[model samples]
Target: MQGPLLLPGLCFLLSLFGAVTQKTKTSCAKCPANASCVNNTHCTCDHGYTSGSGQKLFTFPLETCNDTTSSKTTQGRKELQKIVDKFESFLTNQTLRSTEERQEISSTVTTILRDVESKVLETALKAPEQKVLKIQNGSLAIETRVITDNCSEERKTFNLNVQMNSMDIGCNDIIQGDTQGPSAIAFISYSSLGNIINATFFEEMDKKDQVYLNSQVVSAAIGPKRNVSLSKSVTLTFQHVKKEDPVLTIITYVGLSVSLLCLLLAALTFLLCKAIQNTSTSLHLHLSLCLFLAHLLFLVGIDRTEPKMLCSIIAGALHYLYLAAFTWMLLEGLHLFLTARNLTVVNYSSINRLMKWIMFPVGYGVPAVTVAISAASRPHLYGTADRCWLHLDQGFIWSFLGPVCAIFSVNLVLFILVFWILKRKLSSLNSEVSTIQNTRMLAFKATAQLFILGCTWCLGLLQVGPAAQVMAYLFAIINSLQGFFIFLVYCLLSQQVQKQYRKWFREIVKSKSESETYTLSSKMGPDSKPSEGDVFPGQVKIKY
Candidate 1:
């Protein structure tokens, strides 16, 4: 039994080895064309042509197209021309085929045939079409050609002209999820080979639903053979919406002047108005300033760079700033909770100090770290055109998603505890549970401030779809507008800042056109501030 089994196994192994060696020789190995030395066999198929895999250009067993004396060379040439024409259409990547590519392949086939004493066929033509050597009566005659070595021998090693518009692309292929249309899909090809690249999964779009918005995804790489290819893609959960009900365009600037002016003044308030500045409000001011500046820079930077990393950097930073502001707002919540619980509000001097430090890591550190890790793990992920992104890695959920879920949970607990503490202490005040009661009113006020301060900023980090573009504008408005709101609240809503504002407002209101009043502390001299007449249209001046 062992002898019988061993015999078949050895034979099978030998045949497989012979097939592999022949295939390898065919791949790049050179041997006599149409001639084999195996057991004195003179006409074995080309080293690799018939021994193993697919068809070979010069399979050894058939080097000469015709060896009969009855056949005419002209007819054989036409037959060979047909095969060359059919296959030449298949070469797809070279822009200009040099004589070198054509020559190398010719030499490989000729070397094998000359060894068999048979006529060889070889010729190199121009980039578009090629010609073959005339073979008749077992003799060879060739045409003189200049360019060679530019065509691929492999079946897929051909050139294809691809012309596509980035705007006409759709996301139907990527978002393929549980029985729905593709979350997103992209098809891209390059004019170069040996370079591997593909589009990333991002953006939420559906053409079956008649939605039209180009997905924004970008990736580029140089493959092993120095072939250059680039791909970008994005995918998201499917949602249906009216196509005409929305449009985002540069023309959306119709009413943008007012928003821009307000944002500018809001920005200047923190930068120039010392009386309105503080650590607590400064964070909001910086956030607002960054957002406005980022948008402004983006508008200027687009179409300016070879690759456009600045727009992406500004965009990503804007998102990071939004979250940072929210981190600060979280700090605000913790602070307000302490204030509401104590009959006397807690002093925030030290806590604010600690918070100032904490916000950097919570707001800046986490996003930065996550981005860095993702880029290092796979640098192809950096500065993608896809909307605010997280890594595809599962742990990325823990970085951003974990924080979001944790923050929401913490907010819930803190919110409940705030009410619980208030209710327990409510009995001591011996008052009915009036919605507008003193403590309740104060809590409501705090809640309102929290909403005014951190609410919009928190909308990011929600891990939603490609809404970052829209959410980015919202982040800018809420973020930049917060500076003005904070100034109005702490500086104008309070009696101290308000009395000061009111006194100054009245003085200016009642002043002579020639004489102006200022708000840089009444104790200071008139020389301490700008003249009241200095007021200009659309410009806000708060001296104090």
Candidate 2:
């Protein structure tokens, strides 16, 4: 009985394998161009295409892919209707045989497909330059020359140019639980496979709600929360957007390079120069170190977004490091204010002790705790597919922005108070000439101090509306070269640092001259020793 059962099971397994193999072959054999078989039976469309019923682009008869603009409450219908008329006129003028189909895939979306025969079918002509439109999730997407159907064996296939207008993308489904508006993002199919990749922020129209993208951009998604699911169908719009600006790229890389060099030099100077060793220099050193690490990590690992977990870790690190740098800047401002307050005193020993007690714990510990809290709450939102930084969705970016704003506020207050104190002190001096000179010096230092302490980040907050470009450039140039300013003000211009450099330079030259003379005397000959005539009167030579 056992042997009989075993034989039957083996036969059943063999039959099942054969059936699976046959199904796989059938799916692949019938799969359409630009489509592939998955799981041995299902044929999936390539990245830029979608099925008629809003399913994954599948190889089904009568299935048509549609591109569309944004879906909504009939605001932009007039413009879209004009485009539709143009499409119909094109079809009529060409005498192209076509069929129209309307699909109600969901309660919110209606997909319309106007299938026009290829020109190659009518005459011995190349395929007409056509455009394709798809509507899903309340956006309009247009694609030109979507299909190339010609007579050659490699190219002979049905091609389509589709257009969609005024499709409804239910806004209720897109917003989900979030109160903020959704962002318009585009999705494209992977070149080598059937998966989708989001290519967001390609371009925006002059109108508030509409976006424009290219044919290469296939689907449009709402918001950074791409993972969110929606109950209704979406229509994506595609239009051409300019590539990344070369000028912006040039500014960023060049500024970062100069900042890195200056930071490294400043750090070295602080470490090696004992004369400048104090609470101020120590604070500057730590500030430079934090900024250096933050910048270096960003430049190297920002684009390493492949492994999701690693990208999240990088985002967390960046969050902590940048916060720490800003915290140190805050500490620097506090230290300066303290110094200014106590300038009338003979010594700063008390202030030094007080700073030592306060600076380190606040500078390093606060950012760590904040980051830890943020990570604990929503670690998954730490990074996006394209950026290894905090997600803008669900107010996660506030974790960074909040601390920066607080620090900036505190620093600004400290700056104002310091200025007031300086003004009062200058007024107290009896000599007019001395007071004028001191006032001038104080004014320059105050301006430089505000910039050095990361106050230029204010420009970032003010970047809005028409002047956004001007503010953006100013923000980038000022903040990116902060390390250079620190080096210039704290290291190069400091009297103590300059004196130390000059002292070291003279000693180095004197030592080099003595070594050269010694070398010349030795190279005269092995037996040649310094004589009384060659050497100073007190010099003596010993030979062994």
Candidate 3:
């Protein structure tokens, strides 16, 4: 799996097999008794390539496949017949005459589509798997699979697979799914005719499928031979392969559902649950809210093409929102340090929600706005599906690099102050010094997470080399699981938040118990306090 040898090797083998292994035009060795090579290339059947009459291509295509003056081999004709029958059955099946039938057909088609696409995925999963495949024909894909396919289960899908040497196929482009699993399925069926191979995931029983054959270019390919690699466009139907694991999508579900619900809960907690609204808890709650809302909108509405155009808009916006909220959380940590620095009285006049909100906009928002404007003006500069990231235009160096510089600068300043202050305090006091050390360490961890996130953005610039891919996945997985880290640092691991949460839980339980004790299910009396079940304020119990 040395880097230099992989792609070139694949290209050579593919080109070799495709260019040389090609059969010489002659009387097909597999052609029937009546079959004749009138054109010196194609082995014409008594009928044609169509069903019921045309002899198959067992040796119908290449001249080398011909056996002049001899009858077609039985095996060759039967194999050809099999291919014809599969296509013919689609044209004639009467079971698919209704809307319900089409849905059923789509399901069956997916099963078959998954088989082929999975081959590509499975092959890719192996050690030193092919990351990209370039087809000289219609740039088709082979290793794609279905992900998040919980529409229904217990249904089996029917699949068909083919391997061809050459075909009359031309493709514009091909792409992988945005996520690990396949997002769509297509049944693009086509014949090689004279010099190419065409493939479809499903054949439309009728016009209802409205299966339009569209394509794009990608740097990858899947084939009959594992070793042969070619940059030919092999017509492909971007098949949707189903994903089977529930555990993998737990976070997706959390972000899309539970995390979103947490946004509302956090907001309500702030408004009604008074204890959750202090400086530290409030900041954490607010950060959680922004993340929840942004993802909710992103997951639900970012799929349509015209609206999909909002991918950049959404990506840019979410980037800011995500970063801004995270920044705010960082800022909150800074504020705590400032208070410890004896600067607590600097802004005790009144709580400035507006100022805090401004931090989020400035933190994630400014960068988002900057990147969006940069990408819109020079979109090609934006990374496509391969890099699978937000791309910036000419000034991206500024938009991206600028933020990193600022964030890192701020972190440096904080750490310096912390170092100086902690050093001075450690000499006189051990208990206080230990507390400062742990607090500083938590801030360091948060800062490191941000640094990593920033690095993810920077890595987009070098999407060409092998290291870039490793870093890309690192960025993707880390960013994807950031919430867990935040939870660990702010809630689970932070004893401060743990104490607050325990106190809040007890209050909720106590309030619920009080309600039941008094039989006060309905708030008929004005003096009645809203039950903890109705409100979600995080209060520092200060139990002592």
List the global CA lDDT of all models: 0.42, 0.62, 0.45
Residues 375-404 of candidate 1: C-alpha lDDT, one tens digit per residue: 456443223233333322224334444554
Give me the displacement of residue 235 in model 3, in angstroms. 23
Give me the overall lDDT of model 3.
0.45
Model 3, range 301-378, lDDT digits (tens) per residue? 444323234554555555556556646645654654454454223464334454465555565566567666766666
Model 3 lDDT at residue 402 = 64
lDDT tens digits, residue span 299-403, model 2: 888878767789999999999999999999899889878866765665889999999999999999999999999999988778754579986545789899999
- The Cα error of candidate 3 at residue 112, in Å, is 33
What stretches of model 1 exceed 4 Å from their correct place?
A: 1-279, 282-306, 343-353, 356-367, 384-409, 422-427, 430-442, 449-496, 507-544
Model 3: how far residue 340 lies from native, Å = 5.6
Candidate 2 runs further than 4 Å off: 1-243, 430-443, 526-544
Q: In candidate 1, how many Å is residue 92 off?
A: 16
Query: Lowest lDDT 10-mer window, candidate 2?
Result: 190-199
